[model samples]
Target: MSTNALPPVVDTDTWQKELAALRIREKAATRELDAIAAQRRRLPMVQMPDYVLEGEHGPVRLAEIFGDHPQLIVYHHMWNDGAEWQCGGCTGFTSQFTRLEGLASFDARFVIVTHGPIGEALAYKRKVGNTMTWYSTANSSFGSDVGAPRDGGFAVNVFLRDGDTVYRTWHTDGRGTEQLSYLFGLIDILPYGRQEVWQDSPAGWPQGPTYSRWLDSDAIAAAYGEPN
Candidate 1:
């Protein structure tokens, strides 16, 4: 293997000392993230209108998406009208979450919402082997009202349900949504760190345009074969 693009080699004792020093900063960052999450938990929410979204079984109320769960996490997938494929970043990121049974124990449910028609969205979901329940906001203002308008980018949104009422709790997009992506998190810990041009890496480290290496739904489907 080539060491030209790798971190400098050092003595065992020296590496241990450097790793220990970095661990201290890592712990501090972890603690700061805990504090930020504490603040996020205390954030106020806003009541939402009774928006009806299109589902496989017809119109479904926003609150109904929660089912028996009190909390709902929605991934607003970016869509392209009449296109055969969708956003590669959104598709790859979302496809990582194929199973969410663990969230049920916490009284939380995760789902996907998009501006595409319900049929097309579900078709793409199957094509990409995405098992998450998906809904369509194409016929309602839910997409635009929740910061994921038609032709816009992807987003992550949280909602709370009380009886039949729903309230928007939190919304994040861009890099803020990275927390939900295990792919990004795993890549971030690597030496090259995403290998994206925007990242601060060593001079000889490999780099490419953002999302250039991301695979779209069709590519993922082709790689993994058709979903059963």
Candidate 2:
């Protein structure tokens, strides 16, 4: 019944080495991502449909968002109607997405299409404080046409267009775990953790199994400035 003795703490030299290793691994990961991008780039091109959809301006064609690029990546966000039940995990994935302003270099336009109305979706965007371009498929067939689930979930759909041809290149539809690649989980290795922040919160605070606590009507309003 004796306790183990402790050795003198290292002065972060080991930690520094570990950090270097992590950086190396990150580079390797980046190379892998480049290979995957090559695969995606090799996908055959098609003419995107001339279908017009509502945008912040009004009716906008799918080609309008593409600019000079022929590829588009759309994240179908499920911003629920009210605060009763929202996908906490999606909030986290989107939180990371909001910071990517230079995504155009990927030769694709990354936009978010929501199931909520334009007004409501804008409110959610404001609340979440995500700068990613957003559009509401609330009044359009774009959601179901592209197989966006009626309920709510995250889908990363890649489309390629040539002339007027639009073809679906790739799509990933995993609700929770799949987001690790897109969310903070991809870059997080801290001893603290990835998404347990909302869980390990102090008492008298809202706690949940997902990252939804950071969202709510009030939070949305605060971020977007009183949904008008």
TM-score of each: 0.96, 0.65
Clashes of 2: 10
Quote model 2's TM-score: 0.65
lDDT per residue as tens, model 2, 76-172: 8766776543455565556665455566677768788877777767666666666777887777777766767647566777788776667778777
Error of model 1, residue 23, in angstroms: 0.8
lDDT of each: 0.89, 0.65
Candidate 1 Cα outliers beyond 4 Å, as residue runs:
1-4, 225-228
The Cα error of candidate 2 at residue 128, in Å, is 3.5
Using lDDT as the measure, the top candidate is 1
lDDT of 2 at 207: 33
